[model samples]
Target: MSISARRHTRMATVAIAGAAAVALALTGCAGPAEKPADGEPVEITFQSWVPNIDRAVDAFNAAHDDIHVTLETITAGPDGGYATMLSAVQAGNPADVVQLGYDAIPDFLINDALEDITPYVSDAKDLFVPWQWQTGVFGDKVYAIPQASGPLGQFYRADIFEELGIDYPKTWDEFYEAAKVIRASDPDRYIAAFAFNQAPWMIGLAQQGGANWFVPENDSWKVSIDGPETAQVAEFWQKLIDEDLVKIEADFSSEWNADIQNGDVVTWISGSWADAILRGTAPETSGKWAVGAMPQWKAGENVSATWAGGSANAVLKGSKHPEQAAEFAVWLNSHTDSVSILTEIGAGWPSIVDTAAIASLQDAPEVFEFYGGQDIWDVFAESDKAVDTSWSWPPLSSTLFASLTDNVKAAVDAGTPLVDAYAKTQADMVAALTERGISVD
Candidate 1:
């Protein structure tokens, strides 16, 4: 939570412990392991934001009498409870297992606040999507259990395209063409809006072979948030704004919601979880929406990239019930029944490769009802496959999001060009990382 400048030793230093020591830490340190007495159970506290976590925890408690998990819901914070979780950890009274975003793992790990759970789920490596699995890992140790994945997908109005005689656009060029045609039809209506406040959209675009700001060095990190490919993305959007082809509006505001409901905003580029959002916000437009793939660089390419909103379950190292915590985390994330329940209830997209969970979503009448009876789960599932798994997030992802959002808003308001915003974001990112004793090559 504190970003004060401090002088330290090597910035990129990560101490790798032996597997035996890691196992001991996961089992409550080198002391004698505590076992529940004849009737007593090893209790572990789980802090989470998911509303349906009780369903899973109750099932777990009923099935296993030895390890009981008590669920606690924490109020959501602006930074997604990052600062609150750190404060708890610093106070030496952290929850045994906590809900965590994959992007924030590096920050917690850098502070040595998470427990290495590799010893418990070592053989469960092939249970999740390969890319989602990578989010839980730091160095050679696994610090978290992946619960959900967010792959980008585009949701558009089916009726609008039908009315305008425009088929779905496959390539960026056709998308641009569609934008021009649709926006010119009405003064108040536009194809879509490029919201400057949300940096996840920009991150998703950058992952589409446009640019990658962070690269892995030997033990350090290379910070380069600006490049020719990223500039290509910015320049394309800039042209759209310059020609008035797209609306530059604030995201998630009352105005934006009104635009969507009023048919002023037709197409939405976001992750799989957005299906729930569209259904919840504009029930008036029910059956008018349909899901599809995002526009790619090439006409035939099917590639897409991820945006915001994915979290993992991790155990804290200082907990007394580390083994029970690890077991509970693994079961909560990897169990087939739990996965099915979570996905069926619209708890984001499940990262686990549970066939039953996937089957529950595919062609299910309920999953397609909001999208005019179209099988949207299939579209999102395909997008998941097309995500670029090689992309990496910086350790200071929270700071990166804040800085990028501000820079992008400046670009939108002043028309000084998004490339300049990218430059400032890069410099700020470099300075912020270096100030935290992090190596930025």
Candidate 2:
């Protein structure tokens, strides 16, 4: 494919088809690279943050005599990588391939930063989980290859629950009752932490309750940060906060780490990727912790959601070799050699549809032994299948996250109802999108 075929003359079709007039063009508009001389490998660059990912890249280079990919390590997105990638895009120089979170795909599309690689990678769609594949598709165009997923699950201190004679709650109502029991047992401990500062965590909770914060309608976005389902989720947590049944703490912080290590916090409702985080942060609590499916909205129901941990690999807009880059990306995430490496290194759950084929995942005794010898992958597999395929992300997700975090933190410090934060964010989001010339209803 030529560079122009990959480049977008304007913003992506999905987010700005008829909303307003917006223009974005690659400055150089150079022609595609000439065919490589015989026996000369095609050289391309890949930007990513996954730990130990170079093992997979090295394997790719060794297996393919026609292509060689150079890996460039960068800070994780939201910690300067996204800014760096955008700066490179605007400067007419960017890596051939870049890693992006699922929620951030729409943002990249809106900025015209991703290449349309459907011509080269469309056939590989069947290799990944259905919903995960959809994350890279918009308006019949495939912009990326699904790399990994983060289906929701619950991580809890099993020893503490057993000591208190409490079983894992199966439903939200039962979870609330269990919270009361845990709170009554000791004032220093709570069933969980509010973590109001983490917008992605709250978004997953709302999604589990069947909330769609953003919807595409008539080529415009229907913003609904204050939808009823989201309000219900907010109100439920607000009750827990009002009654002092949950602690107010920022997750992954020193205070939160202490709580986890000391058993002051009993459970965490988060993505499957949190397994690595929990083990790395609180190694002392290895056998005491276990994983389970998220508490359902109703008894006997099975539904789940994903967090921001899931990511995809996209060919950047101005790549000189889009076809080779796309081919390398597809193989990096799907080939047995690469998938095994990713599994062993704990790169989020592999996005492959048939995860059972990965030898590392099939017999992870060490992972099982860490969580009291229970097979935690079974829980994650079930959670991954239960995720709602109808859910989607929206453009300007950074703004959405920022607005929600600011409002929720203000509500927490002011002793006001938490649902009020969502209400305020709804108005803030609509106005912000409108000011950017993007239609919002």
Candidate 3:
């Protein structure tokens, strides 16, 4: 398939010259120009959005005498700073290793910018969960290593649940009942904060049944946005908002932060990344929070799972030191000490599953003190097992999300019928994907 007209247009604006200028200004220098001697230290540029990743690189540098990683902060933007890295790649000055979102891999694959890491996977592949290893594969080739896995779960205020005398919900129906009880206890305080404006929630819901909305069928991919399972989940959330059981927030911003800190929002559906947010944003509420398995369809439905979001390290194809870069990527992702450093600083969950780092985390005297002594690692580990490998974000997901935000707000705020709103979203997604040359039929 040809590159989408819109994507092509964007690429044209970032011509080689324009990209070179941007790269020089932003990165200061192109990646290490010459290969270092066997005994001489080798330095490679490592770019990522996570702030604590530098500590991991530092640990790697300290441990290894041959290779040293120079950490670069990739600024976060609407696309999570992917556009900047894409421009760098176009200019033939990409970083040695870059952290990429799972959804962003297809575009890199089509552009031939990502280095196939199949060669390195043989030794380290078994160290990670099966789904983690599968996350970077496309057409039998692996382009990246999974840095972290996000298994969705319910992070709730244990104090609020105790105050309301409600038991932790084990099923969806019970979950709803718990929400109602929390709401009844106080009209002003909501049982949960549903950021209906965010696309992650929709993606999480679709993955709840381990169903992929866009699946390969014969020669083309088929989209099932209005599938019975997804539609039910959407309608339920819609009702939650309409009935005032849940508060609709715009996004994770200042107001949302206040709500969480002040206990205006009692429950939130989030992945492992949320642990950092809870600890950082509401230190006073430490030990007041507890995580539970994601509410499943029934007691024993398919493994309880949802979407996973985290960055992976990949070597760009044009790098001068592909071998060194590939080795750096492997060391950064697979080494237990590096993973432990990243997790200790609260960047995100470690990508390598079943590492001693996990046990070390469990032993931290203060780890669960933030969650009222709840064993968060155990909760997250159980949730990790439930992650569905089939769940993925569409290539043109950003554009589709822009369309859904406006229409979903209209439905939630103006009392529009849920079915009508969903129908409109489906049509908009089809149109958007069609314009991008992605088959939605």
Q: Which candidate is the best by lDDT?
A: 2
In terms of TM-score, how similar is model 3 to the real structure?
A: 0.86
| lDDT, candidate 1, 75-160, per-residue tens | 54337566767776766677889988777776676666787888887787788766677777765567888888778888898899
Q: What CA RMSD would candidate 2 show? A: 4.1
- Flag the better candidate by lDDT, 1 or 3: 1
**Candidates ranked by lDDT:** 2, 1, 3
How far off is residue 299 in model 2, in Å?
A: 0.9
**Per-model lDDT:** 0.76, 0.83, 0.68
Off by over 4 Å in 2: 1-14, 18-20, 24-31, 34-40
Q: What is the lDDT of residue 50 in candidate 3?
A: 82
Clashing pairs for predicted structure model 1, backbone only = none
**Residue 237 accuracy (lDDT) in model 3:** 78
What TM-score, over all chains together, does every model reach?
0.88, 0.92, 0.86
Q: Between which residue pairs do clashes occur in model 3? A: 287-370, 287-371, 287-372
Weakest ten-residue segment in model 1 by summed lDDT: 1-10
Q: What is the TM-score ranking, best to worst?
A: 2, 1, 3
* Model 3: per-residue Cα lDDT over 115-155, one tens digit each: 66677565777776655555566545566877776678888
